[model samples]
Target: MSGLSTTWFGVIRSTIDGNVALSDINLGDPDGNEIVHDTIGKNLICTNMFPAPQIGDADDGIPDPSYPFSTVGRNVIGQCGFVLAP
Candidate 1:
């Protein structure tokens, strides 16, 4: 028989709003100084999604052990989700 295989998935959601500005000015005769300014105004929101695992009873011939199946499910839910931003 082949060895057991496993996979994991996950996702994250966030939204960001901000502003950026750049400016340069020169004043003098022939030689002048350059000035630059950057400013940002933002609002951000972040969320994490996780789900519970499903398991069957041992008498039902389902794998009740918490090594591979359960672990995989937990990992998947813990790491899988979606993000919404505008």
Candidate 2:
């Protein structure tokens, strides 16, 4: 199976108007995409976007449990960013 490691930076806060605003999230690589978990009645409750897992299998290039990490569909925290690996 093919796997991918991605790096994404973004903020996280309540969707309410004028709420306690969280800012400045600099997540490193192996960080997966954002995951929206709505336990509460509302939507966009929490921003669960962690980095991708360390590449390589248990020994070889086998993907770990956290495979197919994507940087798509992340809510606007405040600002977001990403840098291309040279």
Per-model TM-score on C-alpha atoms? 0.13, 0.21
Best by TM-score: 2
For model 2, the stretches where C-alpha displacement exceeds 4 angstroms are 1-20, 30-33, 39-86
Candidate 1 collision pairs: 10-79, 10-80, 11-79, 11-80, 11-81
Q: Summarize candidate 2's per-residue lDDT along 1-86 as a digit string, tens digits.
A: 11222355322211333322222323554543332211112212222333422222221344333332223233333222221011
Expressed as tens digits, the lDDT of each residue in 22-63 for candidate 1 is 112222222121111111133211112112111112113433
Q: Per-model C-alpha lDDT, please?
A: 0.19, 0.27
Candidate 2 TM-score, C-alpha based: 0.21
Q: Evaluated with lDDT, which candidate comes out highest?
A: 2
